[model samples]
Target: MKVRVFVTPKKGVLDPQGVVIETGLRQLGFAGADQVRVGKVIDLVVHTDDRDDASARVHAMCKTFLTNPVIEDYTFTLDEAP
Candidate 1:
């Protein structure tokens, strides 16, 4: 199985990188952009065919090492490996 994880700052959390990007966009005349948030995507393969097992393992991975539980939120999807 293949997994893709998305990590994002929780709402109300300060995102300095996102702020910088928003400011830069405004300076470049992209005034319509607002409430900008930045995040990351992680792609990896887990050798499993059972969806339930894969989900549990990935959830644990996210909680233990993939995200900062205090200020970050994560979501993941599983797909058949190509």
Candidate 2:
């Protein structure tokens, strides 16, 4: 199975990178861009066919090391490997 994880800043947390991006966008004439939040995407392959197992493993990974529980949130998706 393939897993894709998205890690993002939690609401009410200050995101310096996101603010920089938003400011740059606005300066570049993207006036409609607002509330931009930056995040990371991690793509990996887990050798399994069971959706439940894959989900559990990925969830553990996220809780342990893939995300900062105090300030960040995470979500993941699973699919068959190409």
Question: Can you give the TM-score per candidate against the true fold?
Answer: 0.94, 0.95
Residue 13, model 1: lDDT of: 98
| Tens digits of lDDT, candidate 1, 30-81 | 8898999999999999999999999999999999999999999999999985
Looking at model 2, which ten-residue stretch has the lowest summed lDDT? 73-82
Residue 67, model 2, lDDT? 94
lDDT of 2 by residue, 1-82 (tens): 9899999999999999999999999999989889999999999999989999999999999999989999999999898857
Model 2 scores what on Cα lDDT? 0.94
The TM-score of candidate 2 is 0.95
Which whole-number lDDT from 0 to 100 does residue 75 have in model 2?
94
Look at candidate 2 and give me any clashing residue pairs: none
The residue-level lDDT of candidate 1 at 58 comes to 98
Q: After superposition, how far is residue 80 of candidate 1 from its true place, in Å?
A: 1.5
